[model samples]
Target: MRIAPALLAAATLLAGCATTPMARTAGPANVPPGMQYLYGSGEAAALSEQAYNALVDSVRAQLAKGRPATAAILLPAANGTSAPGTCGDKPYAAVFDMDETAVLNLGYEYNDAQTGATYDTARWSRWEASGAEKVAAVPGARRAFVALRAMGVTPIINTNRNAAGAVPTARALAFAGLGDFKHQETLFLKGDADGKSAKDGRRAAIAARWCVLALGGDQLGDFTDALGTTPAARRRSVSSSAYADWWGRRWFVLPNPVYGTGLGSGWDDTFPASTRWTDPGDAASVAQPK
Candidate 1:
């Protein structure tokens, strides 16, 4: 109470600093699952690269075994048989989605999120056409495609980016140094009415002539047409079909948090916010086996 004026001012400043939250001495017990974008950026990139590398290995193994028929087919025609690549009747193809699987859409996504826009078709079309030059290849994608081509497998890109953007899309891939996509046929865009969104018909067409060795994309719809909008529906699709079992083996999925069915608004409605943290000590305890 009797402290000097300068001494009192110094003490007050110290008190303010002390009460302000210090840097966290320890990490949080657990990050909320809903905040994956905040915490899993690096994880997403790493997983995308890992998925491509694994697909390469899977294709290599199937080739060595001389059993292209054993490889998972993304789609089947009425006849239910394509010229298998193993028998040398036709070249094998590795299908991939263009947006987030082959190229990073982070730049466009960040711009859209800043403006709080959701799926502006015209805006997206413009972005796709003009923005390809701005995007970069997803990690390991160029190398993976080049490697596949070296192994006598063709790399086919099946994207929902507008059919008009096909030329720009190919230029974008080439800009990212993935020049292996020279033929327009290799880059199948949403040109036809049937191929705008649902890719089952397009994939089936490719499967008719060439053996599909593997497929890669960020969304479940990229692999097959048997997709449901809900989380339960997605899980059921994988569990119900034998072909869906080829997830890690023949279907390599990249991670995308910016846009996808994975971003759902029902989390808070389903699980109360109170469940975010149970106990501070529970973090280490829960990580250990019971």
Candidate 2:
């Protein structure tokens, strides 16, 4: 539920740099790189469309194979990790994260970039309540929703948005062309289950009533909280033998460079020491061999 501090710091730095009078009036150049890439670039849209396409295709194949014995959600296991929840005679469904996965918060992000403000829960709650027309569906999300419904699989939204804003959140989804989402049924928000920001509890609640065949989100935590806190640990956790195979099969991820847990990592963590190199032309450094 916490926004990455590193990302906020970076935004603050960018804001600090723009204190010059000329920078105040700058247009897109003033926007952060991540915001530019996520909200403005075609690459982000293509990546989102690719994920939704894969999700629809995978869910179709899964349905063709008949009823699965388990849902895609992870449950607390004896080994301290997580395992898929068992499915009984539950109805079929596909669970998804709402923000940046199915709907793009265009207006809110625009404000973030324009004001260069760090993430604020109070402001976000206001947006959730009254920013219905300021959003748009992520590429292919509308189509994916329709397709999943046509295939007889219910599409459910599992978001960390506050339960107090459930009505407006549903309205926002509908405004974005993602169709209707009933709170506590097709839509599960924060405070609906255990009242914690962690979504596993709500996911379990959904799994109890439906057999989720596919899961989609822009962040790793959207799938399971067991993915660890640090970047390296999360990488290893996700790519571990037990979870590697679920990437494009039972799980789908949309690109979200703007802000999230994925944005936290130092230079050393991002690039290993062995991968470090210096240019031969640099006067103060020795060049490392490729």
- Report the lDDT tens digits of candidate 1 across residue range 1-290: 00011121122232232122123444333322322342246776688779999999999988898755544554443576332223235668788888778887545654543343345677776877787677778888888988999999988888777777677778888887777464347877664425346777777666666778898987787887666767666766676655546878888888754456544435553356887655548778678765
Report lDDT per candidate. 0.65, 0.83
Model 2 scores what on Cα lDDT? 0.83
What TM-score would every model get versus the actual structure? 0.73, 0.91
lDDT of 1 at 175: 83
Cα deviation in Å at residue 183, candidate 2? 1.0
Candidate 1 stretches with Cα past 4 Å from truth are 1-40, 74-88, 180-184, 191-196, 241-244, 265-290
Candidate 2 Cα RMSD after full superposition onto the native fold (Å): 3.3
lDDT of 2 at 63: 82
TM-score for candidate 1, residues paired by index: 0.73
* Residue-wise C-alpha lDDT for candidate 2, range 1-290, written one tens digit per residue: 22533264453333334232123346344566666777889988999899999999999998888888888998888988778998888888999999889898889888776655557788888888889899999999999999999998999999988888989999999998889999999999986788878889999899889999999998997898778889899988888998999999999999877678876576777788999877778866555444
